[model samples]
Every structure is written in structure tokens, then in C-alpha cells.
Target: MTTALVTGPTSGLGRQFAIQLAAAGHDLILVSRDETRLTELSMELSESYGTDSEIIPTDLSDRDQLAVVEARLADP
Candidate 1:
């Protein structure tokens, strides 16, 4: 199964990307500072597209947290 990690995916263009990618059958790893919005988006994607998604609420500017996302991208 293919996966795409998307940053700032709680709204606007980022949210659109998440939706489109879910439609395209990519399991999503979503990053956003807003946990509530991220969870909402994940549920919507699952209901709308039947695609599974994981949410990581984080500020990507932090080096340690950025590394966590980087690891997921690199290993996934």
C-alpha cells in the first residue's frame, strides 16, 4: 500500500491534498498543529474514501519532531 505524508493538512490546500490523495488510495500520515482538525480530517477521509489515516499533531519547525516525520517518510 502506498502512503503519503502531508504537512499542515488541516485546511485549505493542504486539506485538499489530503482529500485527493485519499481518493487516490494512499494511506495518509497527516501532520498539523491542530489536533482536533487533524482528527476531523482523518475521520472524514476514512468515511469519504475508505482510506486509513494517521494524525501527528506537531510543529514541524522543531528539529526532534521533524525527525519523527522524516523517519516515517523514509521508512514508510
Candidate 2:
């Protein structure tokens, strides 16, 4: 299975990306600062498409958190 890392998924293009990717059978790793919105999106995508979605609450402008996200992607 292919996995996609989509940032800013709480709204706009990011949200659309998540929905489209899930529809295309991709497991999603969603990153956004809004925890509530992220959780809501996760549930909606999971229910609508039967696809697994993981949410990481983060502010991308923060260097530290960005590093954390990079590390997660680097994991085997």
C-alpha cells in the first residue's frame, strides 16, 4: 500500500488532497496544527473510504516540530 504525507490537512487544498488520496486507495499521514479539525477529518476519511488515516498535530512553521515530522518519515 502507498502512503501519502499531506500537510495542512485541516482545510483547503490539504483537506482535498486527503480526501482524493483516500479515494485513490492511499493511506494518509495528515499533519496540521488544528487538533480538532484533524481528528474530524481523520474520522470522516476513515468512515467514508475505509482508509487508514493518521493525524499529527503540528505547526509546520516551527522548526522543531518540522524536524519531528521529518524523523517520522525517515523511520523504517
Candidate 3:
């Protein structure tokens, strides 16, 4: 299945992107500082669109945390 990796997914533009991507049938990897919100969004998306979602809780400003996302993106 195809996946969309969305940063800041609990708020603002990223949240909108996550919703739309799920509706379009993409699985998700949601990166956000707020674990609670990410969990809520993941469940909602799963129930609403039947899309799977994974949550990664980290502040993207941290270099180490950002590297995690980069590594995921590098995967084939």
C-alpha cells in the first residue's frame, strides 16, 4: 500500500493533508509532537477511511528526530 508521511499532522496544513491523503487511500505515517492528538487522528482516519496510520512522536526541530523521518523517506 502507498503511504503518506505528514509532519505536524495534528495541526494546521499538515492535519488537512493527512485527512485528504487518507481519503485518497494512502496509509499514513504521522509525525507530531503531540502524541495524544496523533493517536486521535490516527483512529479517526482508520475508522473513517479504513486507512492505517503510524504515529511518531517527536519535535521535528530536533536533528535526531528529523533524521528518523529522513530515513523512512529513503526507504524503497
Candidate 4:
């Protein structure tokens, strides 16, 4: 199973990308400042497509948070 990392996954293209990827049977690493929305989307994807997601509550504008995301990407 492939895993995809998506930033700003709570809305717009990122959200659509996550959905499409989930439909195609990819596990997800979803990143966003909005943890609630991320959790909602994760649950929705899981229920809809049996998708599994790891949500990261991150604001990429913060360097420290961005570093966390970078590390996850490197190792995930």
C-alpha cells in the first residue's frame, strides 16, 4: 500500500487529492493546522473507502512545525 503526504488537506485541491488518493486505496498522511477538520476528514475517508490516515496537526508557517512534517515525510 502506498502512502501519500498532503498539506492543507482540509480544503480545496489538497482535500480533493486526499479523497481521490483514498479512493484509489492509498494510506494518507494528512497535514493541516486544523486538527478538527483533519480528524473529520480522516474519519470520512475511513468510512467511505476504508482508508487509513495519520493526521498531523501542523501549521507549516511555523518552522518548527514544518520541520516535524519534513521529518515525517523523510521517514514515513
Highest lDDT model number = 4
lDDT of 3 by residue, 1-76 (tens): 8988898889889999999999999999999999999999999999999999989898899999989878877883
TM-score of each predicted structure versus truth: 0.89, 0.95, 0.89, 0.94
lDDT of 2 by residue, 1-76 (tens): 8999999888899889999999999999999999999999999999999999888999989999999999998993
How do all the candidates rank in terms of lDDT, highest first? 4, 3, 2, 1
Candidates in order: C-alpha RMSD to true structure: 1.2, 0.7, 1.3, 0.8
Backbone clashes, each candidate? 0, 0, 0, 0
lDDT of each: 0.91, 0.92, 0.93, 0.95
- List where candidate 1 sits over 4 angstroms from the true fold: none
Candidate 1 minimal-lDDT segment of 10 residues: 67-76
Candidate 4 displacement at residue 67 in angstroms: 0.9
- Using alpha carbons, what is the TM-score of model 3? 0.89
TM-score quality measure for candidate 1: 0.89
Residue 67's C-alpha lDDT in candidate 3? 93
User: What's the distance in Å from true for residue 76, model 1?
Assistant: 3.4
Which parts of model 4 are misplaced by more than 4 Å?
none
